[model samples]
Target: MEEAHSSRYSIHPGSTKMYRDLREVYWWNSIKKGIDEFVAKCPNCQQVKVKHQRLGGMTQNIELPKWKWEMINMDFITEFPRS
Candidate 1:
């Protein structure tokens, strides 16, 4: 069971993929639950899995400008033909 869960071919797939792969040649009463537990304990999976939390939120400065247009910004764009 440990070999299947941490084997090279299995490659630490998620619980679903592990369950399906194990089912190809093995059977058990709590296969899904066992696979979930195994994956949850897998160090490699924990190390590389993407976190599911939101990233940092947007932020804006609250400082005031001393004069008009002091804090304003502009961008100039020019287009040229491709020859």
Candidate 2:
């Protein structure tokens, strides 16, 4: 996918998806390991890799609310952000 605006820097999936559709959730854990492997192959990390048809489905509870500010919280998270 071509980035709407860019300067040859590869777009992180998180940034691109959010910019185009705020509700789109690009779950890192939900995608295949191969997606990361392919991106890592990009020497500049600026290549916009094409999206392919994924063949699996997973629904997780995601117990944490709004993920803690500085941590990857999957099981639980505090409402407050540390200062």
Candidate 3:
């Protein structure tokens, strides 16, 4: 995003084809990079005025468990008698 955004200010704006060529070289047809997505969705690129979005309620993410379910499953099997 920084490169794309900076390109906007660079007076070139992907004019040199470096970004596009590099995309074709490394990404090899996968078109979902965050920077490309950002540039594609840029209001400036679309020539549309940016609208302010209202803040939405934030949702907290659940904490990650320290171990995998497979490990816990083995423990559960050993610790519990047959039901």
Candidate 4:
């Protein structure tokens, strides 16, 4: 399990993919549950897992410009001479 999960070739696949890969060569009762538990306990998986929840707070609206050039955005990069 550790080899299939954490090895350079596998790189920590999620429970579903891991189960599919492992089932071809190995089988055991309650294997799905075991894979799920193993993935859930893996710290590397937890750190990078995508969150399914909505982002916090409401979106704010930007005000429309009332006149020409009312709102201007500029970015400048200047190189200074080194002393």
Best by lDDT: 4
lDDT of 1 by residue, 1-83 (tens): 68876778767778888788889999889888988988898888887777944667789788898898878778987796778
**TM-score on alpha carbons, each prediction:** 0.55, 0.22, 0.28, 0.61
* TM-score ranking of the models: 4, 1, 3, 2
Give the range of the ten consecutive residues with the poorest summed lDDT in model 3. 70-79
Q: Each candidate's lDDT (Cα)? A: 0.81, 0.45, 0.52, 0.92
Residue 75 in candidate 2, Cα distance off native in Å: 50
Better of 2 and 4 by TM-score: 4
Which residues of candidate 4, in runs, are more than 4 Å off? 52-83
Q: Report the candidate with higher TM-score, 3 versus 4.
A: 4
Off by over 4 Å in 1: 52-83
Worst 10 residues of 4 by lDDT: 47-56
The reply for model 2, stretches above 4 Å from the true place, is 1-10, 14-30, 46-83
Better of 2 and 3 by TM-score: 3
Q: Model 2: which ten-residue window has the lowest total lDDT? A: 1-10
Report the C-alpha displacement of residue 28, candidate 2, in angstroms.
14
Residue 20, candidate 1: C-alpha displacement in angstroms: 0.7
Best by TM-score: 4
The alpha-carbon lDDT assigned to residue 73 of candidate 1 equals 75
